[model samples]
Target: MAGILIIAHAPLATALRECIAHIYGGCPARIGALDVLPDSDPVEVVAQATAEIERLREDNGALVLTDMFGATPSNIAARLATVPQVRVLAGVNLPMLVRAVCYRTTSLDMLVEKALAGASKGIQAIGPGTPAPEYGCSPTPCAEAAADAAEQAAAGATDNVKAASGLSAGVLKPAGAT
Candidate 1:
């Protein structure tokens, strides 16, 4: 079994662990959240989280999940990435946490993929189109609704990517839109 660690700004780590427990029951021997203060030195906090991570690694190879890419938690995790037994992922969310706990026995690479996929799926919007066809929804109309919903989702995803890449949504000229 793989060991999991979560390091995040403030109380995010604790909240995420609670969410995982709620979704899949409690995880045995997993470490979540380093005890630190807002005014605590960054290096000290990192060192604390790292120590816990190392301890968990003794039992099994460990995966560290953090809240943001360049934030303190992730930066601390990055420093420990040189350890062959430790792998780190940023942008940890409830879905990713749940998936990690669910697939704790899987290989590291597969677990990372599952966590990423779960994070992506977690952000999706649920509407009338997402319900099952057996819920008194007609097949043909349901198909059309699903297609429309998917198209909207794609558009939203593209907009988010563009925004993250520092491109203004209005700056991108659609091929067929004026």
Candidate 2:
């Protein structure tokens, strides 16, 4: 399993980890974070981040998630990328982190793909909307419609039901079915 290292502006990294723990009951092992203060020395911060990345990766490689590109955190992540077995991604979000942690058993490239997919799918411009009401429609039609919407929320969903609903397709399956 590849370790996860979150490098972001101060508090964002910690807050994201906290959010993950709150949602998942607990944060998984080998997941670490470094909150980069705006006023902090970039050189010193990079040094600290390097050590954290090394510690988290251990013998395995690491997936580095940063809050934004061109930021200090991302800059450090870029520097760390030169090191062996370290991959960096910008625009880190809660969904991305959750998916990364869940699929840590996968290969580094696969995990990156999953993370990007998760992050992109998680974003949605949700607004007030009501489920279509059909006077002659039965309950089954509504259920089927929801399932269809999930599957077709966005074209080319390879990793599963990563829709605006935020639920995985696996959740709809019966135990031992897969």
Best by TM-score: 2
Compared with the true structure, all predictions reach lDDT values of 0.62, 0.71
Q: Which ten residues in a row have the lowest lDDT in candidate 1?
A: 165-174
For candidate 2, lDDT tens digit of each residue in 61-156? 799999999988899889998888888999999878876765554457767887887788667764678443385532321133235445665665
Quick one: best lDDT, which candidate? Answer: 2
For model 1, residues 1-178, the per-residue Cα lDDT tens digits are 4678888887888877776555434534565665334687888877787778767763337888888898777888788788887788999888677666544544577668767877776676669788754857332211322343346556774543223221121111112312
lDDT of 2 at 164: 23
Q: How far is candidate 2 from the true structure (C-alpha RMSD, Å)?
A: 8.9
Cα RMSD (angstroms) for every candidate in the order listed: 15.2, 8.9
Question: What clash count goes with each model?
Answer: 0, 0
For candidate 2, the TM-score is: 0.72
Residue pairs clashing in model 2 are none
